[model samples]
Target: MERILEPELMDDEQHALAYAQADFVEVNRGFVDRFRTTFPDLTRSRVVDLGCGPADVPVRLARLLPALGVTAVDASAAMVRLAREAVQRAGLGASIRLVRARLPALPFASSTFDAVIANSLLHHLAEPGVFWHEVQRLGRPRAGVLVMDLCRPASPSHARDLVETYAGGESPLLKRDFYNSLRAAFTPAEVARQLARQLPQLTCRVVSDRHWVVSGRLP
Candidate 1:
């Protein structure tokens, strides 16, 4: 299936609210766990999460690694607000900093982060190469990087099946968004090619029926 582009940012209030309220406990936890397992020697103190929707992963990472400082960035104001509330509720205001910024042009200086992580963010971009470049520009040499996102299915029917199988109980808005995301997602092969041109050190693999992950350290 050809990739269908969705809106780059979930800036709409209702869309953001529905996405923030949706149950992603297992998925988010798995993402954090995967990062920890992939980079067990992650001794760096500075970490940044791009497209940190609701900040659940950031909060979880902070709780798991109390010494590390997390900077979570999202383009959507509503998502940033929701993330702030989540961080405050988790009593991790000091450990996690929430920033509202668009991608491919973040405010941070080059090589500012020890690690760069993003979840479910790649498919939103029309020019993913630029996003990869930004990730490369932000991370210091040998910095850990883990990016996970939906994998485009073989057909639209498969996409709908995935939505039904995984997000059947979610709200209508959430379900619709999931479908659109699946449609917008990149295949593992395509992601691998992108990494080859922009982040050759990274490894792209299909981690699940609907997800692919690119993980490794910067050169």
Candidate 2:
């Protein structure tokens, strides 16, 4: 299937914004803990987060890794503006910097960051391969890419599990958004396939049921 250059504008931007505000605490815990455990050695390292949304993860990363300098980039101008405000609200105006850049073309030179993370942003992409290629281009050999997205269900039970977990106790709009994300998400196998085709030099793995952290050194 030919891919649309830009995926549909998020269905209900205001609702999405509201949902993020309400659900961010719950949604961020898993990713934050996972990152903390996964990258314990990081200190004063340069980290860049793509598709930073409201910059929640970057804000958290700044708090968690005070020695680490972070640059958060997002395609949405509104989101970047919100992210800037979020950083300011957190009193991290001195540390976390926000940039507006589309994912297809990261505004950094090759091998710029020690780590890169994109949370809940992959599913919105119409062409994950393009984004993956760009990610590789921006990272050094040892840089890591931590990606968290909905898991693709392989059977009825898996599907039911996801619906129950992600859609439970949410607004109608939130439930609908979760369901759409699952439908759009790539399976671990699919992620691996794309990695092989787009970033064969990288060591990529699905580190959790609903999380994939792809990392490796450049050959």
Candidate 3:
């Protein structure tokens, strides 16, 4: 399927709120759980979450590892705004730092974080190489990397089925966005090839029917 790029940043207030209010608790919890389970020895004091939409993953992770601090980065101003409130509501203001920065152009030095993670962030990018580059550039030596994202469907009918199944109750705008995301997402094999060229240390695999997970430690 040809990639149709959607708006890169979810900057609008009502739109961002629609995404923030979307019921992704289970999916978010799964991302956190899988990260912990896969990297059982991940004892990093500092971690970075790229494209932290609603701070759901960051909040859950911070609460799990009380000693761990998270730097949550998102390109959308409204996303960061809502995330601030969510973080405060969870009383995790001290544990998580929210930064409004566009992906592939983060304002951080090399090896700045002990670990890096992103959820459903890749499909939104037109230059995924930038994401891969920043993952290595910003991560500490052998920094743990955990990334999860939707997988592109084989056909339009399949994509529509997924939307109907998963986003049946979501608002029309949000549902359209979700469908566009699925259309833009890459398959596991495609992502693996990208990793091989830029970040051989990371491994990509299909983790669920709708998602692909790329994870490993920086070499």
Candidate 4:
């Protein structure tokens, strides 16, 4: 299926609130677990999470690796606000720093981060190559990288089926957003090609029925 672009940022108040309230416990936990397993030596690295909606992954990672520092960034003001609240509530305010910034133009210096991670962020970009380039630019040589996002279905019917299968109990707003995101997601082959051109050292693979992941260390 051809990709249909969704809004780049979930900036709408109602939409952001609904998204922040949605249940993503299982998937978020899986992402953190996989990251830890992929980079076992990264016990005390400085990590950056791009498109860190609500900051759940950062909180989870920080909890798992108390010695690590996490910098979570989101372009949407609403997401940033919600993420800050979550960090404060977790009492991890000192371990996780929240930044309001967009991809392809983050404020950090090149080779500053020990690790670069993102969840469900790539599909939101209109120019995904630029995002990959930014990831390469930000991480130091041999820095660990892991990015996970929805894998575009073979057809629209498959997309709806996924929505019902995973988000059947979600609010209408959340359901609609999920459907849109599924439509907007990229295929593993496409992501591999993007990485080949912009980040040849990374690897891409399908990790689930509806998800694909790109993981490896910077060269």
Candidate RMSDs in order = 0.8, 3.3, 1.1, 0.6
Give lDDT: candidate 2, residue 45: 82
TM-scores, all models, native as reference? 0.98, 0.84, 0.97, 0.99
lDDT per residue for candidate 4 within 23-138, as digits (tens), equals: 99999999999989999999899999999999999999999999899999999999999999999999999999999998888999999999999999999999898889889999
Top of the candidates by TM-score: 4
For model 1, how does the per-residue alpha-carbon lDDT over 118-207 read when each residue is reduced to its tens digit? 999999999998889989999999999999999999999999999999999999999999999999999999999998898899999887
The parts of candidate 2 lying over 4 Å away from their true place are 1-12, 24-27, 155-161, 201-209, 216-219
Candidate 3 residue-wise lDDT at 218: 94
Lowest summed lDDT window (length 10), candidate 1 = 36-45
The number of the candidate with the highest lDDT is 4
* Model 4 residue 202 distance off true place after TM-score fit, in angstroms: 0.9
Mind giving the per-residue lDDT tens digits that candidate 2 earns over 1-219? 121232433424664375456566755766767677777766678888877878888888888878888889877766776778889899998778888888776778999988877787777888788878777788777676676765665654565577677567767666666656666677777777887887776655665665566555444
Give Cα-based local distance difference scores for all models.
Answer: 0.92, 0.71, 0.90, 0.94
The TM-score of candidate 1 is 0.98
Off by over 4 Å in 3: none
